[model samples]
Target chain A: MQKIINGKAYVLGDNIDTDQIIPAEHLVYSLSDPQESKKYGQFALSGVPRERAGLPDGGVPFITDGNYESEYSIIIGGSNFGCGSSREHAPFALQKAGVKVVVAESYARIFYRNAVDGGFIVPLETTEILKTALKTGDAIEINLNTLKLTNQSDGQTYTLVHPGDVLPIIEAGGLFQYARKAGMIEG
Target chain B: MPMTITEKILAKASGRDAVKPGENIWLNVDTLMTHDVCGPPTIQIWKDEFGGQAKIWDKQKLVIFPDHYIFTNDPHANRNVSILRQFAQEHQLPNYYDVGGERYKGVCHIALAEEGFNRPGTVLIGTDSHTCTAGAFGLFATGVGNTDAAFILGTGKIWEKVPESMKFIFEGEKPEYLTAKDFILQILGDITTDGATYRAMEFDGRAVYDLNIDERMTLTNMAVEAGGMNGIIAADARTEAYINERSSQPYTVFKSDADAGYHSVYEYKASELEPVVAQPHSPDNRAVVRKVQGRKITKAYIGSCTGGKMADFVAAARILKDREVKVPTFVVPASTAVARQLKEDKVNGKTIHQILSDAGCVIAPSSCAACLGGPADTIGRSVDKDVVISTTNRNFPGRMGSKQAEVYLASPLTVAASAVNGVITDPRDAMG
Candidate 1:
């Protein structure tokens, strides 16, 4: 299935930390209901209200029926996505908030690996075409099977292929899902 | 053939004749770690996902430290400790340290290093990103997620891909005033923060070899700060001498082949470098210490996995001996072991803790404390617009509470000197 993300982009300039993705303070809360975590993004910027209920223009997008609105699906960030700390909650919060894929110039190794293992995060290469084509509220379609990322605004397309067993894992809904299908887990 | 530190650790873990860059293999982790916050969730995941059993690869191979919120005055933190205690008992994990009444050890990285968990030619993994600190002892260490930590706890095995190696070559004489912290900060400034993502940084050259084990460990400890999975300094005679002083454990020597190829290489001359500090908001925001001089501080702290080594404490104590802490200073040794060493050296009351305590310093147990806000050490409203010059890793906003407050990263000596002056002063001034 190919889904296009359309929303005002709350683009990060570059080099976001796990603490910024989700503060250590939020980890104190119960992990059961993710909607509770919708307030998570508000804490990213300091001095701001703890509950910035009004969604940022490119806040987060949801392809699923029951997800946050203005909620962005695809995150177009600068180099080194997830640059600080090894908190899995960083990726978990992003996934729970309906971030389908992250398009960045590069990714921190631990973050890249953790995102892959979790399964929901699909990190695409940040090429010039994709970068130039992307803006706040511009739509993007990312096809998992073909690794095709299209910027709907300029009709620009990019194919990302890297040497790894990661594609199948993302397609299978992350490592656990892939492991389950591979008979690593008991039915 | 001289094997790189990475190859040596891999060989030991995999029982291979030799290993090189760019090979994926499962290696036995010499030491595995989890903190309070990450540990609780990983334990929950282990029970829910992997079932309750000590059916891991080895019983003696795991180590757990409750350093994150050891001084937590929060009710939720207290509850988490109880949950951790239950998990500890069920798993029979022998190494557990508590806080308050208990003899609290410092942060995990410092405790492990002091207790000899980190050694050359071994691979270590911790749930904390700063686990990369073990790289200082020539061990190949990296941080893992709670889920992966759970799998390791359940199975005692870790999956890893051989990474491309980048060599940081340092040459030249380090001035007496210059320390490893300055060297590393300079390197971070040179390479920027995201410089070595996904690569293993192998420290090389004459300047690196000159560093003592503690100093070298400080260099490797913050490798994650550069976004690298791990950092290694090839074990040499200096390393061998240091390891021999600490433990009788047998260590297989590991050094990169003279002709070993690195994917990328960088060089720095230590003599040309001066004290560098990471300004508030990011570790990569580098500036000369001279630029940030005279910034008044409300708190000045010196301790963390990265900067709380024995050497750092001793250095801080020396600068703070006759001086006093004007702000509400906190001088925590990294671990109980470091505290013991300070005591044995007779530098405790005469120089460090006592002097600072007499000067209104709030002495606390060795833990992540204010670095990660362990309740007892978090910031209060009174601290607004105040500055902090701390030796702990990361100077991100609200790290020490108030968003309006400023936090500066500097060496322990600089931090201690600033405490004495009640402002951000250079250690050079205090030395005189």
Candidate 2:
């Protein structure tokens, strides 16, 4: 695991559901076909109401129209983030759009498990709500070793909850890898 | 140690005598269900991980239903179903229900009950979140993503954290106007959407026990809407009758110990409740039907696993029997079986299909039409600024299509009542 990871933050408010992360209309696309899967990135977080698309101010697009990748590298959200469906596409879309980490006050269970088990992105639960504390497009540094998030844009810092039992899974880069290490599956 | 029914089911599935909440353990999955939306991707991952020699852990234990996006022009959507068909054909999996076939069942969740995959004291995991609907059988059930499902596919095992159970009790004779939808909507308003996160929701009391199998399914189906690991009711004679009609397989039943611990308890009297709806944009944003009465709506829909059952249609038919709807109404049964029943079942001496059609409801072919807003051509899908009253789960923004549209989630009776007035209306007034 990297000790320090740096990225730009794209924040959202509470109840940011899986439908908003990747709309159902886009679910028909392939997740394995390299070229076809780019649609997931292009439409990542596309369903969020325009007013709640970004934090602090909102109305910012995560990806430019017709583009398959996003400039944002990290997502900051309030409680109950990813609270709707169990579509793994929500996280797959984010990772495909270049998101490396998600810092939220909390998460819906299936989304949290999918993030860790799929090794698509790092879903970090913060002890406190930082959705209002952080702004979209702010420079940020996350230290996995220290479990702290430092905002280079505003010089603010926040503590994140430990990953607990899921830390090994994330470290091994998903459930399959973790299972291999544990000798639960044929290596 | 005393354990909740969910814990006990998990414990047995894991080969343990007891399990405490929050403990992670490997569970032997009794069944794994997947549908068109998630099945293709899960198969892709399973094959990739298990290599060229990939084989399903137990062919008979896997159930695949190509339900979502079945009646679509989208090539990709059709291709997904094709993938599931080919995979099932290769494996000779008897449980595979294909599209355009006599066995094709609509909406995986409702089909799960009609078919006999759900049994008490077992663990069922599916790729769709609403898979928890099977928990109505007193089983441990929840949803997982493609990777976890892929893991289960290869080994028939997946890891789960035991969840604390929450209790909901409703004590009263079920009112004629009150449906399971109203009770669950009331619970959502009280607990918010994430109130029961990572916990089991166990329903009991006379009113719950009074409900038939289809209505019980309505309660468990939306457990995922509240982030619950599962919503369950201990199996009884009613459950046995329903399961026995479809499946002859032997099964075990489980109930919570009298001394089991609960994370929380919510109690309500059924007689005190009235018609209710989860207002547009969120399931947790709730209001009494009377409170929102006269709120103008452009369309009315009655369908999906949450609604659209035989009982759901009977409720709607009772309200629409001799009246015409003021709005464009849609009635898409959750399964073809329900559709056939509509044609044969009677309401006030007329078939439900005839009554709904006379009432100006467009009876669409079942397969989850417009409930999740499929391809652009889907029937009943919401459009820009359209206000809809629907009998479906989850009113999240854009859940039924167009983000600009609004959806009010209500019971079939309430939806039918509202359909008659072209606005949100209480079922109580119409019942008279």
Compare the candidates by TM-score and give the number of the best one: 2
- lDDT of residue A26 for candidate 1: 58
lDDT tens readout by residue for model 1, B318-372: 7777666787777677787776665556464374556555556666656776675
Query: Would you list the C-alpha lDDT of every candidate in the order shown?
Result: 0.70, 0.92
Indicate the DockQ of the complex predicted as candidate 1: 0.43
Q: Which CAPRI quality tier does the interface of model 2 achieve?
A: high
lDDT by residue (A63-180, candidate 2, tens digit) is 9988999889999999998988889999999999999999998899999999999999999999787888888999999999999999999798899899998899999999999998
Question: Which residue segments of model 1 deviate by more than 4 Å?
Answer: A1-9, A30-70, A129-133, A153-163, A179-187, B1-3, B52-54, B100-103, B236-250, B347-349, B374-383
What shift in Å separates residue B143 of candidate 2 from its native position after superposition? 0.8
Q: Identify the leading candidate in terms of lDDT.
A: 2
How accurate locally is residue B366 in candidate 2, as Cα lDDT from 0 to 100?
80
Q: How far off is residue A90 in model 1, in Å? A: 0.6
Output the worst ten-in-a-row residue range by lDDT, candidate 2 chain B: B366-375
